[model samples]
Target: MKITILGTGGGARAHTAKLVELGHEVFVGTRDPEATLARTAPDIMGNAPYKEWLADRPAVTLMPFGAAAAAADELVINGIDGHNAVAALSAIGDSLAGKTLIDYAVPYIYQHESEHPWPTPWGVMPKLDPCDTDSLGERIQRALPGTRVVKSFVTQEQTTVVDPKAIGAGDHTMFVAGDHDDAKLQACELLRSYGWTDILDLGPLVCARGMEMYAHMHSAIGFGLNQGFGGHFGIKVVR
Candidate 1:
């Protein structure tokens, strides 16, 4: 499978590495290849810089956003920032048509630093932008008419996403939702390949709300455990 992942952050690197490890051809899509290669900021989950991550995976090709999508043969994974997704993907134009788009973007608004602290309980919770109205998945689906948009892994951090067992979390179920059945099936295979054992098929792309909103609750739980932005835990549901 020829996979193109959009973004050069932790999520993108994690997905790209796992897919490549699974024997799939993967390319990374970024706004600017030069800047992407020079990026030194830590990812949302506090992983090392993109340049550092890329150093380990020399086999992966990094290209401009549109070129990556245009080169995709099997899947296109949305690993970019939620707010930038529509514009970035829109720039790709019709290149995404007929591809299974696994969207993991989350549109969120952080509270002002003055309004909140940086520690647990109060200051640690994250706020989402489109709650009860829309989701990144629905917006992307609308942006690209013919693309099959499926949302998954919005609830997990990069490590948990690529390796569900990494956090010692047991049976923490991964949820996937999309309007197209075949697309979801293909995504499920990819998820399974990345070592996700327990997955739930939540129907329809609109259900992305629940998955996206899980971000807030997931953070709360993380902070509660003193794992603020640490990406060291996951949730497992019983029955």
Candidate 2:
């Protein structure tokens, strides 16, 4: 499968690593190509020598955001922030008319610094914006009338996203909510390749409202649990 990851954050890198591990062709698209490349250069050099040594690697592509969406095959995961989701979508919304976009944004309207502790248990789990009554992923879905938008993987830490071995520490579940059965299955296959053995399909896209809220709660768990950096959650099903 040809995949395009449209962000430069850790989540983007995690997806890239997992997809490449699955032997699929992956293209990374970012807004700030040069800056993202600089930040990832050292890590790529140390961890992904093959990708780094690829003859056609672009480190970052310079296309407009809309162009990036047009270039993808069947999947699009929004690894960017909730605040930027609409703008990013606007850039590529038209081109993504008939594709399945796997949305992964938590619309936290507020955040904190070390000095200013948040009232909530998780600083990352701030109150969302007024307009985010439903959820940004849902909003993205509503905005793109034709695109099949599925929400998933918004309830965990960045470090645990691609490493399934780390799931033994009580962090390995990835939550998904979408309207399309086929799109969810395709995403499940991608998740399987990323070492995610367990997934919770929380029904349709409306369920994303609950999933996003839970992800907000996880922000504080990381700090309080002392899991510090690599914490995540997964379900162990018994037959």
Candidate closest to the true structure, highest TM-score? 1
- CA lDDT of each prediction against the hidden true structure: 0.84, 0.68
lDDT of 1 by residue, 1-239 (tens): 88999997777877898888899889889889997677677765577877888788888999999899989996999988887888888878688989999999888655645355545544544466778888888989999988999999898887678888776644688899999999999999988888888889989999999999888777777767877564577777678
Error of 2 at 125 (Å): 5.9
Instruction: Give the clashing pairs for model 2.
Output: 122-220, 171-232, 171-233, 172-232, 172-233, 172-234, 173-233, 173-234
Error of 1 at 32 (Å): 0.7
**Model 2 misplaced regions, further than 4 Å:** 32-63, 111-125, 130-132, 169-172, 228-239
lDDT tens digits, residue span 17-72, model 2:
66776766776666755554355344521443223433344443434456677777
Can you list the residue pairs that collide in candidate 1?
none
Worst 10 residues of 1 by lDDT: 117-126
Error of 1 at 182 (Å): 0.5
lDDT of the structure predicted as candidate 1: 0.84
